[model samples]
Target chain A: MTRGRGFFPIIRSWSIAAVAALAVLAGPAAVPALAKDYSHIVIATEGAYPPYNMHAPDGKLIGFEIDLGNNLCARMHITCTWIAQDWDSMIPALNAGKFDAIMDGMSVTPQRLKVIDFSIPYTQSPTTFLVLKSSPLAKMPDTGKRVSLDDDAAMKAAIAAITPALKGKTVGVQVATIQYNLLHTYLRNVVTIRTYKTTEEHDLDLASDRIDAAIASTSYFVSTLNKPGGNQFVEVGPLFTGGLLGKGTGVGIRKSDPELVAMFNQAIEAAKKDGTIRALSLKWFKTDISPPN
Target chain B: MNTSNPFVLLGFGPNGWGASLVAGAAMTLAVSIAAYLVGLVFGGLAAWARIAGPRPARRLVGLYTTVFRGIPELLVIYLVYFGGSEALTSLGHLFGRSGFIGLDGFLAGTLAVGLIAGAYQTEALRGGFLAIPRGEIEAARAVGMGRLLMLRRVIAPRALRFALPGMGNVWQQVLKESALISVTGLSELMRAVNVASDSTRLPFDFGIAGFALYLVLTSFSGGVFRNAERSLARHERAR
Candidate 1:
């Protein structure tokens, strides 16, 4: 006989109540707001993803996003405080008022837009593959080519070319990231996919031979490759952006803070216009990832 | 490549993360102490309820312990750390207050580990209470000792002595359980190792270092508890 009143109903009701309550609470908080005077702002970053953001041994936050955020914050005339949040919790933490905005190399995508708003992209670098120099994947087709995922023919060609080499291989990407989605869409069936909390984890795993290849932004891999013992790793596969990779990396702000978003957008635009972004990208990543016109 | 040497990675030099690792160890101690205090409050109440309260109150205590003990510690930490604040904020909304209410990592981790420790501590303290000699209470009552006098003079002393060994075990459990709090992003020993391993790309070095650090912490605490047990039991007759 079924348990009296049933456990399923209790769990269902509990979850339904939770969801409804959250919806009610989240509703008013997310209603887009009018412009407000900028005074101070708090920005969060995942201080674990190198080149984008990571912590120095001295416990200081340093990386491309930190530099870029500071520049933009300066231009916007806002005093900013930075906090390091884990990658998975960054969005929820932002929405929860743990911080005013997120500059953790977050990508701008329609899916994300459903929850939060974004400043116009500052870095539109394509996603690419990084594998050991000796791995079969390192020699996969079109190593130096750039393929836009938005292009139907190029997408078809790139997928067709890389599928065979990836068969039965293990690939790793950070969990809940744009790279995960890209891997899911293109390589899930062909490869055994592993997800990690941060790029550092997958990178470490890749180094320890726990994973066959890793997927992330070329900008990250570029900075990574510059590190000592990095010569052992090589970029693999055609770089991808647009479709699943997102519009590009942008500052994630609360959906309620359209004015904050507007301010960041303006600052980012000026930086792009004046080559600050390009210069920083070069210093940190040794490449210009500033959005191409 | 420069960090390939373990000493270089662990040294206090500019390139080394010695400072962070030590700071992380210190944070682990702080969080553990905070969590232990929380466990003490919850455990004391649960034990009292189980020993003296009505049937329904006892059952509620049972349910609390059962549910917390049944789930994995990692799951408990995640559920509380990630979901608790959201739930609190939602509940707050019903009262017409709005905005996200956040539980910072340290507070969230402490509450979580404390809860799990409370479940264990309840059993330990209850066992200690059960072992208290009924004759002593009777003798105290016969001597016209009031309830408070009996508790202060007889029950508490015997129960605390018996509870020492059990509470020692619970303390150790809480110390180890603090490692699970790392997932919530509290800068504890385990998370420090994770960061260093990732940054240095030498997983084993950091892994072994973390293991050693934890061993040092637990063993040092183990000695303290052992000495405490001896001191607390000094008046008890040798069996």
Candidate 2:
């Protein structure tokens, strides 16, 4: 979900982009010397999305990724304390040195990679639609088919297939998300796209019929889609990934820290090889979300 | 339905978020107080520069007030958090230093909000100084008081009386702006509401609680301001 700074919260589109661009250009920062030891590093997460990173009733952060993140740090011999940062500031905060890294469900989009580096994706849950089951669009064409945005003709064919169903409809998505971007790219001419700061806000609005449909990661939807009174909405539309949707969720880090990147990369590799990622994925998501090798 | 149970959801009782929310509000109070002091330092200097300095110095202070007040508050914070170090590092190398100097989130936030608040405070203080009777300053001059004595004896006390209400409004503004510091991962009132909402998935209850808490902070300060105004004005009888 897109969370950020502001009084009115005007989407943080300009200031964040401009500053992040400037930071990238400003060259090396003054940081403590890179050490061989891995005694401490602060990691951040949004704690808004579930089964990835969300807080338990006692305010303890609990989820599949939290468990795996701690396991990775242990393997790397690093002591880590997690901070729950708002999603919209995760990149800026990381770059600002508020935290050393981010473990939020941040997709590895090319646009994001321009500003921050990522570990190889730990989860690649494809994007899909959640709509009221009573809606006529429930039978939306190409349901269950995986549509990669890189496939030009096939992508167009799928877009054309669902165009009429989405026309004049109001669709909800978390602000600044790839799902929001896709709405602008493919469906802007057809529907009104409403953006929320969190997936849960949109989910609540969806249940109250404030919007006709919403699109988010299937894994995120899984966290709440079937919670009580959630039976009304059914997952619809072709699952999407690639191109604007990017590779999948990864740990966001500053580009200058190749050591941290390499460390996380090895940890993710070890987790995958040992089936730790898959087990945590299944335990939390009821599905395997570990990225394909 | 899981979010419907208000007391258990919002309470600090083991499962409730009662503790975190209180702590977050306390953080908001802490940052706002620090930022207010920063503004006091900047505003005092800027107001003095504007009122007594040479023409060029006055123009520079004028420009400072205009630019900071003109841009939106959020942009100022972004510049502080993201752009501050980047600019500092480059500015560093220009003077022959290498490496990075990172600003902590709380520092960045306090400076940004305080910097903006200082712009308004400068104008308020300047107005307060102008309101002082010019004859009083001449009398101070005739009595052979030096600049510092005049400032401490005649100017400071009077201007402070006039400036309290305006500074009170500025205080409220700073308190509200403290919520924006949440972007830098400084846990405060707004961030607390967000975390609580996401945690409980019940935005309304948390939203109401947040609104009430802000009201308490604002109205509590308003009461203090009113009392301050009365106490400061006590010397002036009803003529």
Which candidate gets the maximum DockQ versus the true structure? 2
Looking at model 1, the pairs that clash are none
- Which number leads on TM-score? 1
Docking quality band of candidate 2, CAPRI definitions: acceptable
Task: Report i-RMS for every model.
Answer: 10.9, 8.8
Off by over 4 Å in 1: A1-38, B94-96
TM-score of each: 0.90, 0.87
lDDT of 1 by residue, A1-293 (tens): 01112100110111233335433322211211112435766688877888888888766789999999999989988778777778898887777655578998899988898999999999988888999988878788988788988899999899999998989999999998888998898777999999988887787788878999999988888767977778999998888888878888999988877888889989999999999999999888888889985
Instruction: Give model 2's TM-score for chain A to 2 decimal places.
Output: 0.87
- In model 2, the Cα lDDT at residue A17 comes to 32
Residue A36's lDDT in candidate 1: 42
lDDT (tens digit, per residue) of candidate 2 on A83-192: 77767767776765556788988899988899989999999988989988888878888888899999998899989989988889999999878898899999899889
TM-score of chain A of each: 0.86, 0.87
